[model samples]
Target chain A: MHIDTGSWHRYMALPAFLLFSLFFLFPLMQGAVLSFTDWDGFSTPSFIGFQNFVDFLHDARALQDVRTTVLFALGSAPLLNLCGLALALLLNKKFRGKQVVRALLYLPAVISPMIMGSIWYLLLQPKRGLFALLLQRVGVSGQGNWMLSSNLALVIIVLVNVWQYAGMTMVIYLAGLQAIPLEHYEAADIEGASSSQTFRHIVFPQLIPSLKINIITNIIGSLSVFEAILALTDGGPGYDTESLSIYILRMCYGNKTGYSTAVALMLFLIILIPVFISLRFFNKVEER
Target chain B: MKPNTTIVADARKTRLSPRNRLDWYLLAIVVLISCVAIIPFYLLVLLALKSPIGGLAAIRLMPDFHFVNFITAWQRSALGKAMFNSLVMTAGGVGLLVFLSSMAGYTIARFPGKLNRTIFTILLLCMMIPGIINTVPLYTLLIRLKGINTYWAMICVMAVNAMPFAIFLYSSFIRAMPVSLEESAIIDGCSWFEAFWRITFPLIGPVTSSVVILQGLGMWNNYAQAVFFLQDKAHRNIPLSISLFFQQYGADWPLMAAAAFLGLLPAVAAFLVFQRYFVEGITAGALKG
Candidate 1:
């Protein structure tokens, strides 16, 4: 049952190299090149240099999209990770109806964001939705036209993202929680540590790995958030919920390709920062 | 650890007591959150039964159970073609993804050296590059390739986006697998490729199934890619068709809900069946960090 690793590596490496070059490297390099140019689909790029980048900074709507994207990333990332961590902590203990509760909690994660957006669009319609109807019953008029406003729509979109993604974050946290040796908890219990103290001492330290991943993913996803917003408002009500992706779609397909690529470049830079931060942070924390 | 007498006594008291006010408070909070997650689908069904105009006038708490709305949406929306397109595209994408990723994962895992690490890191970088960031160039490429109207283009894009995570999962799973099995196969005169196909692939089934389930859900539920790539009405997939249904029947809440229900059925079914493994697959990808 003996074999050589050398021949096997030689046999497998070539195809893997080919696949990576074609699928990963080629498109990525081309994207970087395109970001700098004003290439329309038909003609060769005129090599406009840094003009696209300059215009991206000055464009008011593009800037607002950046602002809204940051707002969403900042708002949703912590909330989703924290909420998921809390849920995982609660469900980790012995309980009744725990599986059913966990299933119900995780159900929203499986539903498509676009479908959820449609449902919310109907349910949150002004003056006629369930929320408004209930508000009317309670003597508040106009409780439902929330998405019609720009900031409020952004808030709601963030909330929806939280609801959808928290299930995933929770599952990852649960795995991290389970992997924490019981001896640590027993030691804490033996020391007569308060629940809060034990959480800060043991659970918080152990959850760093999962938290790093969840925060980075949530930030990146919220920055590029599109399908739900598109299905919900089409970035309407004066482009309130328009994210970088929606802006890019408008540019590429909406006869604003030049402008959209500018937006895309900004998105690339924005996501790149968080990714680098996450990598550095995770490495440092893990080292300790 | 320093033992605190008073804290120990309080902990014992809390442990001895079966139920507490705090536990009740926690239970109530959990139930409330669960209800928040559950109520939307119920309301969607409720809204679908009543007249769209009536529903627009005032929200009804109870569903009218108008199943006919689904039929109406199906007939008017060209949902049949959309479903067909989605099934074919997802199947094709999963097939290609499983093929390419397994080969790459096999190479990376078996090699376990500098080149492998480089390739794996590049794949991770691929994962971080949000799909939208490349839309301009990708769209241009599709247009130039004249693949805008074809399912093959959509399938290729999906497979590429899917490859990195797939390779990651497969590599991790394969690395954990004992090398002796492949060694034995090779000793029996199996070539390296044959050893992978005969010995390695079977052992990787659990992870592969999980990948298939996850990617299948993603490809099935996708909307933006289909919208960007498929211009012809006849070429549109289910998600795009659902969006189209909304456009065509903006006033018909019942019909739109029906269309959504149809659009979501496959994914929801897969979710229910493979929920456990799907969770495992996700944790594997994220926890490696």
Candidate 2:
């Protein structure tokens, strides 16, 4: 097997390496430097030496956005997993037209979240929405729009997010489910194990891989929540529901490029913590 | 013998009765949940079908089937142009991604050299880093390169964003394949590069489709970057155009819904046609890696 090592095949990675380095790696490194300077996205940037990071510590709005982002992730990640696992279990049975049902469930995820948010807004619009109209028909009146409230709007956003993305989680979980050998279920049946027991003992352990993927992704996705909030609330009710990602965008456009870049880095750290924790947790679980 | 037969029949009857009831209950729940899943889309359709005379209050269970709103949405939103832009970018991005990543994957899978291993590690690590951190600098760089709103720039940006996952998928897939296929081609007077293009590349159609379906959809529905890069109307993709249209026509329920629906059609159509690959792609990419 005297295949030549010095050949054109050796340079196969060059194009992708060049493109990714130019577009992704170079900007990321530059962002690290830009975060410490005072750049307004126009004009020259001067070294400011961690001022942006210090300001983020004292900024009330930035702190509040961190809260909102964390709250959204806390609410969204679990519900998405719970609902997705439940859906996977429900749809795991053998039946006619199952593929169609699976596709229908996944349809929401396929559409852009921005459009999905708009559809939800249309259906749940304050007084003139389809829901309000339906409520009026049923003799209910004078109910305030919950979307106008701060906490409730966040709750609504969480629910809408779970609704849109649970199917994605379920698809992954479904793959994990389908991989479990039929013999395991038969063995459980022979042992007279109940459904819950079967799940805890057999299904749950095997599903750890899918859980890791879903949880880590959900954490990152929820933490960086953007278009959904943008389309739904526009981080409205006095910026009460603004996420860190949305805040970063606003700051970048609001003549705070250096600070926004710093905030973006902070968001990356926030995402990293939960993901790291879960990875460690899953490593322990897999070991056990 | 008669008593034994009667006893067996009795046991069968007991098992069948409860199983039948459970099946019916499961069906009921499935249908109920499916309705909840579908209602928002149903509402979108209903509103899109209604005329402007009645607004949201006039929406009903059945669509008015106005049909004219789609025409108006098409004309007013200039969705035709947006679709063209989206298609071109998606096609270009996916094509470049497949070309670049497939080659990268082949080399990375076949070779465990220090450079290849390091490149793979760096890519996998970058996959976890939030892209938002790069937004500010990337935007500035795009401006410097005169790349904003250009197809090549947008395509390159998207392909790079998707590079890691595509490479991961391709590498894992190629690793599982027998190397003897390529070895035979090389023995027959083909260089390793030529062998890859002629033999290996054609053989990995499944991976190619997976990459295309998975990343192509993301490129089509791209908003976060497009909002920053494609500010001009002429360069707007589907999501950007629809979002802008919604902002301008927030009060026009029928027209807004019409625009939304038009934007959704191509994605829905693509999904329906290629959904099998879609699911398989997600499963393979996630679990195998």
The prediction achieving the highest TM-score against the true structure is 2
Give lDDT per model, in order: 0.77, 0.88
Question: How big is the positional error of residue A91 in model 1, measured in Å on the Cα after superposition?
Answer: 1.5
> Which window of 10 residues has the lowest lDDT sum in candidate 1 chain B?
B13-22
Off by over 4 Å in 1: A1-20, A254-259, B1-22, B51-59, B113-115
The estimated TM-scores of all candidates read: 0.91, 0.95
Per-residue C-alpha lDDT of model 2 across residues B210-254, encoded as one tens digit per residue: 889878988998888899888888999999999999999988888
Q: Give the DockQ (2 decimals) of all models.
A: 0.49, 0.62
Q: Report the error of model 2 at residue A18, Å.
A: 0.9
What is candidate 2's local distance difference test score?
0.88
Candidate 2 chain B least-lDDT 10 residues? B13-22
Residue B39's C-alpha lDDT in candidate 1?
82
Number of clashing pairs per prediction, in order: 0, 0
